[model samples]
Target: MSAEDATQGLGIDALLERERAKLDRLTPARAAAAVELQGALLVDIRYAALRERDGLIPGALVVERNELEWRMDPTGDHRAAETTDHDRLVVVVCNEGYASSLAARSLHALGLHRATDVIGGFQAWAAAGLPVTGAPNAPDGRA
Candidate 1:
């Protein structure tokens, strides 16, 4: 489908269901535990504009959604040069949860067995009153 056609409102429930089936989702509480245990690589997949509009979670690795697969796969030559390890757990985040879920699943398909996405995305994490820091434009420019 064309970009416009693809984006044409697929009701929230339908979108959520699709995400649920493809992704391993974690609640903010669970995500917090993963962070504390240092078992997850929290990947923020939101566009830079959205992150600037909202606030960012401190320490979240900024991997844009489109580049997630390449960045997370250590065996793939396309993997980011900075990524030297493949076994790290990955928890991806998007504006809501859809895109990140998709991204996380892609990572899983790439063999990062521990990849998943936050249940409600950044909004949910923020709403849960989780620790978030950094100025609005600290990481300026979209991915």
Candidate 2:
């Protein structure tokens, strides 16, 4: 089935609830503080096309949605070797908040219990007038 069809009949709210159950969520403000004080790893799960269409956060890691689970799980064979030291906080993000929430929860399942998503994703961060970088094509100087 097509992506839209798979989610047919189930509204966005339901999908969000399903995701929320498995994930921790944070607002843009909290995410920013976590980045500054706790050294949380920011993972942008938006597609490459989206990143090119709208710039990325300067220091955020690009883990693409498909690879997120494998990369964060230290014990999984597909886990990125670099994450063997898994004590770090991990924050996942997508274009908006929906997908990232689900992704963050998946990371939690992999042992990064601190994993969470920005409440409004990049847009919210930009809307809050927070600092951002990498959106060369973005209009209004935001990403």
Candidate 3:
């Protein structure tokens, strides 16, 4: 096998756990409260396809995963308007919870001290009955 194949030795599961180990992730409800009460910025880093299929959380900024570090770096020109304050709490959400952990960690590296991820990601947020736009089941927030 080539070097690429060997790189998989750690496995995605182990890699995910490693990333999660460095994060202080928030629960879906807590994340919602943070956005509502503490002025936290919620970032949805799922791909466009996933967002199109599963819908989105209302008010959450949709930034793709690959562009997170740049778009969220307070000092970067590419940073979003909400990223101007490094002290702001940032909660990142992925399809599940894995990629969000890594994304939050990247934000931390960018001096975003309060960056974090939703524990169970978008699914949990919807399950918790938080308001979402588009296809995320209305009223009940089931899907």
Candidate with maximal TM-score:
3
Pairwise TM-score winner, candidates 1 and 3? 3
lDDT of 1 by residue, 1-143 (tens): 35764879766677657656866689988888897897577889898888778877877888887787777788877776545576777788898877877787777787777788898889888878786765454344211
lDDT of 3 at 135: 72
**Model 2: per-residue Cα lDDT over 1-143, one tens digit each:** 36875867557787678778766588888888898898888888889998887777877888889998877787878775446556788888788888898788777777787788998888887777777766685555565
Candidate 1 residue 39 C-alpha distance from true site, Å? 2.6
Error of 3 at 127 (Å): 1.5
lDDT of 1 at 75: 81
Q: Residue 46 in model 1: shift from native, Å?
A: 0.3
For residue 74, what is the lDDT in candidate 1? 85
What's model 2's overall lDDT? 0.79
Of 2 and 3, the candidate ahead on TM-score is: 3
Highest lDDT scorer = 3
- The TM-score of predicted model 2 comes to 0.79
lDDT, model 3, position 11:
78
* Local lDDT at 17 for model 2: 87
Off by over 4 Å in 2: 1-12, 21-23, 76-84, 137-142
Order of quality (TM-score): 3, 2, 1
